[model samples]
Target: MEQNLSLEQIQNFKGKYPRQLWYLFFSEMWERFCFYGMRGMLVVFMVGQLGMNDRIANLQYGATQAWVYAFTFIGGLFADKILGLRKSLFWGGILMIIGSVILSIDPKNFFFIGIGFTIVGTGFFKPNISSMVGQLYQDGDPRRDAGFSFFYMGVNLGALIGGYICIAVAEGSMWQSLVPEHLRWNVGFGFAAIVMIISLLTFTQTQKKLGTIGISPLLEIESSKRKRMETLTYVGSLLIIPVIIVMVANTVYTDYFMMFIGPASILYLLYEMKNFSAAENKKLFAALIFIIFSIFFWAFFEQSGGSLSLFAVNNLNNTILGVKLSPNGVNNSANSFFVIGFAALVGLVWLWMAKRKIEPNTVIKFGLAFLFLAAGFWIFYYTKFFAGADGRTSLGLFTFGWFIITFGELCLSPIGMSAMTKLSPLKTQAVIMGMWFLASAYGQYFAGLLGANIAEASEHATNLEKLNVYADGYKQLGIYALIAGVILILISPLVKKLMQEVK
Candidate 1:
């Protein structure tokens, strides 16, 4: 009886979750492993292998990550109009595997080449999977939140594993006897490719149970044109590889590219507004506010991949509570590890408050996220005080700062995803999700700039000089986050009005 169920019937299932959710969960988990693993390695490899200066490495990291995210908007649009979710995801996975393979074969030489494929690939894979998960539940289903939360845990689980191991291998902390120092990077990147293959296979094998959930929207179109459209998407994505590589290698081009895309995206969204009613438009505007704020949030938070990763390499001690560990791995994985530990407990705290009629609304929750972010960055800056004469600091305190930052993430990110879906009209869900990710693109771009400036500020070769400069930069970010949080809280009423009954 269940085998023949349509998308609607699947959504109507009488369980805490439809069985397909676990498949999607595992698929996304492996994809995230590929992604965060690459992220944790990028700047480190640039400095350690390619012989790039700190400033250049930061900018390149920013540009590479920015493009990776910016393409999600394009990927989302292509999925909505032509390929649909399933095809987009499969194609994206293939591209990512290709990218990782390229790097594994020769990471130092083909770094930008590999990253270009990854940028395009991630766009197609990231947003659509989340949308498919949403499709598994009918609107207003009480289980929807739990299902999404379950999926969120999958994301972190992959990040935790990949974050730890991939960089560990790259840094020669794992299988030190097997992986030579020079080839460690090759194996590290290879791990991403290997897991992405797993992610794709998981999706292919399990997606049967999803029924018509993610089918291409063009079945009604004539066959020839549909084939042509699919061909064009693949070719176009491939052709853009060199362009992305150029932009990433030369940071100035990234600025030009973003200047074009950022405003163009706003205009396009405004054009999209014609289809939505006034109230729906207001809710979208509110969602936009959140997206805009999120850019700032991510800019600071993403230091983990750029500046903090470098910080971990240079400044921190090599142990957490007496067990020897890789500081870079800790830097990369600590937040993800904390998210795994605390995500459910934090959700329960919010639920408990809601049941008592005292829960913070989404807007306030967003504000609290910034406040927590501010506190976390402040703690990061305070690490300078804990540093030894050699400028090395306590790994335990550094990881503790991530604990507070995790709270901020718990407050905003999941809630923001929920709000984006709830507030947008049915027709625009994928586009809005794309926009949410695009905002992350902007954040990543700026984070690179921020990290570069900090890197540039320290001319001396001393570890102490680098520590003070980076710590001071973090202090400034903390102050900015503090102001943003306070302002968001102050203006909550207006955003609440825009949200209407969304909470």
Candidate 2:
């Protein structure tokens, strides 16, 4: 029999980590498998099967991902106010399963419709789980960063497996004997749905360990009124599905939506700030600085899913160490692989540095992340110098670049998740985490525009021409990322001052 674990008891855990993190870790792992599976398939499917141009596919990928993260704000709000973390996650998982199943039915025809479901579902699913992870540790727990690091591993582990398998399945690299070439797209999508069900079930069986941590925020409300509020939220969520379909299908609508959401979120945050102390507000502002800079960070780093995917298709040889492999699969899964390998070691490095009292603060870590990001992009640019006559570059160098960026990602992303929880007021933690992802939404939006501009090689352009064009863009991005790192380091004192004792 299961019991309701109190928040106090969960947070009272003073060990290296609480056992609950494992359950959340596994549940989140499966959820990410579903997510990355779909993500790995998206732009590739659009280009190869849907007959879309690189620019259009990039724009569509951006819109789709932007909507996915943007809705996290809405989902976080709902979970904070009504459904609570667990329910929001459960509802979101159901929607994602539905979306993947829909895509499996007829990938090209139902692509946008399926994506619409996924965007809204991910909105509901993404932020709340991170918030719950935050709840496991008491404020000022030294282990919080490592806990998040372990959780981050779950995310990448899923990405590594699904990222490869889903793309391989869709492209007939796997299941070739069973799934016909044309129908592989369907199986690829269907595979995501099957795993999503497992994700939801994993949470269902283990969520009791979370106890009251993710329970409804309306526990104090009258029962009937709570029911009414919950009902309205469910109905409202259903209604947004079609609207999302429309927005995701048209890049122009995506532009409009992004323009509106950013200001609206800021205004809402301003409104919410009235409820907190001056000190908390300062911390919030500090989190805002990180959030603001993160948009640019992602703009450069997120090329993996957008332009880089297409680049892999057009410009890279397909093999690793003379073993036959897919460049696209390598592009899709490489960062996740590196992160999985490095996340824990990186986390432990922080612990060791802290013990020696030589730890770089979060802001410095972020700055260093950008420096590595710059180096990775520069390497990406340099790869073109070694291209063959057919214009394919060294797969070894491309993968090595991802290895460098993985350090950047390790420095920033898991740390950013930790920073949001630390900086935010307890009541608004979900909102802040949502804001963090919303920054990624903007990053994805601009990543699309940047990728589209870089993919200017004409249909008749030679492979070498295409490689040169993309490499030039990457060189520019490298310079920008390097500049961003320097500026962040210069400004770190101010942000660190605001963060005060949080780090």
Distance (Å) between predicted and true CA of 493, model 2? Answer: 0.8
Clashes (N, CA, C under 3 Å) per candidate: 0, 0
Which residue pairs in candidate 1 have backbone atoms (N, alpha carbon, C) closer than 3 angstroms, thus clashing? none
Position 280, candidate 2: lDDT: 95
Question: Model 2 misses residue 461 by how many Å?
Answer: 1.5
Model 1: worst 10 consecutive residues (lDDT sum): 140-149
**Per-prediction TM-score, please?**
0.97, 0.98
Clashing pairs in 2: none
Kindly list the per-residue Cα lDDT of model 1 for residues 403-467, writing each as its tens digit.
Answer: 99998988888778777778787667778888889999999999999999998997565998789
Q: Write the per-residue lDDT of candidate 2 for residues 429-491, one digit (tens) a residue.
A: 999999999999999999999988887554457999989999988999999999999999999
How well does model 2 score by local distance difference test?
A: 0.90
> Candidate 2: which stretches are off by over 4 Å?
457-459
**Residue 52 lDDT (model 2):** 90
